[model samples]
Target: MDRFTERDQLIRKWIYAAAATIKESFDDELDIERKSNRNDLVTNMDKAIEKQFIEKIQHFFPGERILGEEGLGDEISLLDGVVWIIDPIDGTLNFVKQQDDFAIMIAIYEDGKGQLGYIYDVMQDKLYSARTGKGAYCNKRLLPTIEDRPLKEGLVAISSALMSKEEGLARTVGRASSGVRLIGSAGIETAHVASGRLIGYLAATLAPWDIAAGKIIAEEVGLIYTKLNGDKVDLLQKTPVLVASPTAHKEIIELLKSQKI
Candidate 1:
């Protein structure tokens, strides 16, 4: 097998192992700490899981660069080499409070090109993965390509905070789509879009690790992923993101322009 194939196997193994460790930690008292604010929290499980993936990556791919959410990876100044973008626990609040709805995400990019993406819904035991030029999958089942669906007929996912702050967005989405859902987990929301469960997902602000893997999987399934202004999403920058079906993507952009959002 080629290098990517080999790495894919390794990643699957590591992810399952990490998931077991995380699940076990739920039985113990969590060491939680606030990051940017009280709402932005981190737990000891997040750090430990990140460390586990980092150690395996370093041992297996010594020179590869890693940009991780937990800050346990390498100091990646550029996306030039083989880079691993990881979010150990995408929805930390859900994991801490509800013990569900969170996900572990990892993306492998070689010289700025996405090679593989993995989003494991740990609580649900669903693994969404995709390889470049290969089809996306939910566990062993292949995900169908996203069919064209008009914005008005489809369900859109957005953050509750964004919905409240941006009246224009709420109005546009409310009027255009069937309804809106606030899942509080970017990875899970993105997976829903990729799997055709949701027509689109819009985030007011998202970090690189938040959407890196989802972007790869979304693109493989023929979904359009871009900034709100229809710009290409930069993997190294945090910005507003929209992942949607082609029809919904065009319609949403038009609505945003009409509202100047």
Candidate 2:
């Protein structure tokens, strides 16, 4: 098997095809429904797009396992072989409300190691993709090497939920960065980190589907992708995750540990 094409090119084509389908599905208005809460949303477009990805993968790569949002894929308990993790709509809320700022994220792992990652910002027509040993890219351009920047010198991405769960994180973000920005999608935030727009990102409760592509591309550019306490991330579980340049990652972790909220 052509490992790179199986992982990167196929998924990239899948995302583009899914994007077209989703765009047509939502040309007028979206049928948005709450998943867990008002804050957690699911749309018909989300389901359709996810289904499209799952079906394409099943057709092209018959034996591969899929772990996708919207429950369109198989019930997977282990990541043993070729595993595809998909977030059909990375920002469903944004897609439903603003029709922008959402993304389609796909990541493929072989034996639990990231082999390919793709994050497509549908609204902006941007695709961020990476393959193991090939480096990351934003559309056609290869991403530059990630340079370590201090917290005070660059913007940092943090979720608003941290303000309630970890009180000090909000305060720390307020004091630490030149600015604090909240983009509803983890994929977008991590893409920014990969491109050197944001120095760091931290979120408390994220699903595996949410950050899989983000973590892969972030690390491809020499950015640190790990748990909040600086542990390696497990692609099958949820955790408090952080992605950032090396300097900002260390600083943010130390700050979070000290406050301990």
Candidate 3:
């Protein structure tokens, strides 16, 4: 097998192993801390999981750079070589409070080009993955390309915070879509869009790790991914994100323009 194939196998194994460890600690007492704000949570499981990934990456792919959410990776100023962008626990609050709805995300990029993406819904046992030029998948089934759906007939997923703060957006999107959902998990929401269950996912503030893997997987299935202003997403900076079907993407852009969002 080629290098990517080998790495894919290794990563699949590691992800499952890590998930097992996390599940085993579900009932254990957790050491949780706040980051940035009280609402932004980080648990011991998040740190430990990131460390596990860092150790595995270092041992298996030495010299590769890792940009992780838990500060267990290198200080990467550039995506110069093989870079692994990881979010050990994407929805920490859900994991801590509900023990579900969170996901483990990892994206492998070669010289800034996304090569592989994995988002494992740990509690649900659903693994969403993608390889460059190879279609995205859920578990063992290959996902179909997203069909363009009109915004009025589609289901859109938006962050609850954004919905509450941006009244104009909430009104416009709610009026346009068949319905709206606030999942509180970027990875889960992105997966829903990629699987064609949701027509779009929009977030006002998202870090690189939040959308890195999702972007790769979403684009593989022909979803248009961009900023709220319909601009290209910068992988290095936190920005507004929109991943949607082509038809809904255009419609949402027009609506945002009308509301100046």
Candidate 4:
């Protein structure tokens, strides 16, 4: 347990160091590349930051399995042991364009349970983190717990694509809340929910690194995180996701369940 704490501290320091390196690397001349398609993207900084973190993790905790967004880590087909999920840059497009609204996401799992989570808002210099038994925090301050509230009065967080394009998700957003918004990053959206800036967040598609940390930290504040269809989300798979205050989550899930994609 004490060793875990020490390792946790080391990882936090590494996250800060990685963020600093990333901030310095962000320039107008980013080495950007297309992946999957034109809209899907990757950048030199993305790979560099991911490799930096992975290198440190390997140096300190050898044999731990890692699943990174940039494919720099191990390709574990299952989540059966000590594992790390890393999204070196959560908003690569934003990083390449605005250099803001991006995050470094990390999640630690031990024997199939989320043991710890971290989301670093690099530009803002805020680090959000939590251990399973510990409450979530932004920097040193604890995140306020979200109240259980229904959707009609709650501000919703969602992406433009899902709000307008994904039919079932779109209608769920349209009918389940007072408003819908997009911040372009799962880490940012979920961080806002942890801080009570929004009551819920939904995304149509995401990788493990995108939601693993957010899910751990959000649920620490009494938030509910599940798939859009309300199933267990394998932290190792691509899936639709929803995170919300429990009451708000219930409403969103019902709406999603009743609609068609």
What lDDT score belongs to each candidate, Candidate 1 first?
0.92, 0.86, 0.93, 0.86
**Residue runs of model 3 more than 4 Å from their true location after superposition:** none
Q: Flag the better candidate by TM-score, 1 or 4.
A: 1
Ranking by lDDT: 3, 1, 2, 4
Sliding window of 10 residues with minimal summed lDDT for model 4:
167-176
Local accuracy of candidate 4 as per-residue lDDT tens digits, 66-120: 9999999998888888999999999888888788999999999887899889999
Give the TM-score ranking, best first: 3, 1, 2, 4
TM-score of 2: 0.95
Separately for all candidates shown, the number of backbone clashes (residues 3 or more apart, or on different chains) is: 1, 0, 0, 0
The estimated TM-scores of all candidates read 0.98, 0.95, 0.98, 0.95
- For residue 12, model 2's alpha carbon misses the true position, in angstroms, by 2.0
For 1-261, candidate 2 gives per-residue lDDT tens digits of 676775566777888888888787766667778888888999888888888888888998899999998988989888899999999999888888777888999998888898889999998899999987789999999998898888899998887666567766777765888888888898998998999999998888789999788888988999999888888888778888889899988888888788763
Residues 1-261, candidate 3, lDDT per residue (tens digit)? 999999989999999998999899988999999999887999999999999999999999998999999888988888888999999999999999999999999999988889999999999999999998999999999999988888888899998777877978977987899999888899999999999999999998999899899999999999999999999998889999999999999999999999988
TM-score of 1: 0.98
What are the clashing pairs of model 4? none
Give per-model CA RMSD. Answer: 1.0, 1.4, 0.8, 1.5
